[model samples]
Target: MYARPAHFYARILEAPLHFARIPDKAAISHAGRLQREKKTKELKGESDSTSKAKPWVDQDLQDDTEIPSPNQGDDEEDDPGSELDLPHVPYAPPRYAVDSMLERSRDFYTLLNQRRSVRFISPEPVPREVIDNVIRTAGTAPSGAHTEPWTFVVVSDPDTKHAIRTIVEEEEEVNYRQRMGNKWVKDLAKIRTTWVKEYLDVAPYLLLIFKQTYGIGTGGKRKTHYYNEISVSISCGMLLAALQNVGLVTVTSTPLNCGPRLRVILQRPTNEKLLMLLPIGYPSDDATVPDLKRKPLDDIMVHI
Candidate 1:
């Protein structure tokens, strides 16, 4: 005569709830039949879901049960494997339009060839804007690894240019007297180069080109650059061509002891190596160059 909980009494009144005394053998048989029915229903549901999700089967398997094909719409004729056998279209060629200004290439070459180093420059001042444009033009030159490793330092201050000239002349004097020796001097004689660097001060701008030996990374580690010499030379050539193209005269002047003295004078880092010192400005009225001749095309060219 124990009282049941409220939930237990309510569940007993439900129509689905039934209790009966049965033998152990009959109870076991009823449980086994129920479990078999539940498992069969679960397996059927899984197979149906898998078939709906993945209709395409592996090539090794054949579809035993036939199904209606999807391309049954009869407005137009259709091939069963048309989607899988679509043709691939090739890419079209790029369009290359000729530039109108390209006609001046020959004239530009002639103008550049006429440009010569004027040891004697006029004291006329050049516009800073012009120098900026020239440098920008030089930046367009192709470089090794596209790392345009060059620095153009323009010194327009009279005092700074004068000081630089003094340092350069001192080095040049040593080079001509002691370093270059007689043979080198004789070879340079035809060009009429000397230790007197008066053009450095007279020119409106002194562009000192420096080549970076290597780039500094994090933690002060150095990364070696490829084709540093060739890259710097090409950049210098582009700069010279740009200056000449804009109707400005330029003289490429290289002085000895440039690496040490100029670095100290310019207060540059050790990675920056001095390559060429260009004195750029208008030439004097009496400026002249040697009558030098270039090799003919036939002599310079070879064909296989």
Candidate 2:
């Protein structure tokens, strides 16, 4: 075999590192094909992973239903008030000394502590003005995006109240026997509650609270009511407090799977869903309460 020339060896040394390792056309084509296949697999894997992942939260809590936004159309102008910056007003509440604050807090707690859910409500008429004021206080609760998506339907007519009772009883009977599991029924046994809700007819007023899932805007387009359920829940807390303050009594009742029927009977719009049905009045002379204690603050609260 002939030995390679010194110049040839020098040329090889001078060549680029990549040029020295240049593959044949077939080898290069095969590598390119493999790379394309790998990328396809990666993209497919990514799609599958996304499709298989669970939702971040429960479907009921997510309120995933979409509403057609009023400003979505090209011809429609965006609502100017929604985007306008509002001027802030100064807020100054009266301040109290430390001892006074402590005493006030204790007194408020004591007053609220006396409050109880009384199933036996008196049929004596409650002043309409008082109910109005209590509901107005509830409306002061904070809401997401300031939507204030709550409605208080106060029913006083005897026939309408009875109709509500009929609907509630029909659904609650099924809930007790089948919908609510055996464990739930057994647990409620201690409270001596059943499907029978006589207070619905006996009470003087039935306040059916509804949450507006969406609102109508200009041109009849639907606008989103963000976190409507949560907003209404906060308002209900204030309403309950107000009721307690006025020496009135009520039992917060949520009729299971009766929203549609109650909504129809009450002649409410389709956008609204029933959240709570409270029969409000004075407690009966024979009204008795279950002996229950609330959890301690330490048990319920966490401080970081």
Candidate 3:
């Protein structure tokens, strides 16, 4: 019924001509889930000041998702009728040969492959400047409509870390004992994670990434931030990579039911929601990670 199905699949598996011509079942399912999540956030009035468009962008409509073109006419709302608006300058990024690009990618992958999320971390003091640099690197991540929607609360003081650890442990204990069902707990058994998060205070810094649901404009009025989740997620990825590049280790930790308490502790505004907590420092002397293999590329990629 099919013309050379086996040969077609073999060519797709071996060759590299077709980079992204087919969408697998997982891609479709993920897109659908993203669409639903975007809907839920909108219902909660967590909208951006820009276009009230769907949070999820279809592959074909990816360009449309961007609110403004880089060179689009003057958006300086203050002077609506000003004819002296300056146009955007030409972008002149350096071009690299394909071989050099591939080599750099491979080198990066090799470096990052050594990174592991370790629970045991050192209590040695990290310089405040290092923290500032890492968070600043995260801020450079791209965001929707250029509305960089992320706040990093760098907690270094011993007293504050202890307070955060207390609240986090309190909430986690309840989750492990009551909230987390058997299946969920069992699934976590392989990674050897528990409710006792002693590293929260052990690490030199606890960076909390908060997603700004909206912005405060002039006169304290509410303004929307676009694609908040996407923006914050990109920032977090950059945060981890920046930390790793500087020879620091970190574990991505999330505390449930502790957001309200944390907000009070950090004195954050109402529009910000805590998205992730990262404990950053040097790994303990006996730090170890599970010996695991990554999914093969052929399994994840497809061809036309």
RMSD of each: 32.2, 19.7, 15.1
- Top candidate (lDDT): 2
Error at 143, model 3, angstroms = 0.9
- Residues 1-30 of candidate 1 have per-residue lDDT tens digits of 444333343221121111222347556866
Cα distance off (Å), candidate 1, residue 57: 59
Q: Relative to the true structure, how large is the alpha-carbon lDDT of every model?
A: 0.65, 0.75, 0.70
Displacement of residue 160 (Cα, Å) in model 2 is 0.4
Q: Please give the range of 10 consecutive residues that has the lowest summed lDDT in model 2.
A: 11-20
Q: Which pairs in model 3 have colliding backbones?
A: 49-224
Q: For residues 19-67, what per-residue lDDT tens digits would candidate 2 score against the true structure? A: 2123576467656766666677687775433333221221223443323
- In candidate 1, list every pair of residues with a backbone clash: none
**Among all windows of ten consecutive residues in candidate 1, which has the lowest summed lDDT?**
11-20
User: For each candidate, how many residue pairs have backbone atoms clashing (under 3 Å)?
Assistant: 0, 0, 1
Model 1 residue 246 CA deviation (Å) reads 1.1
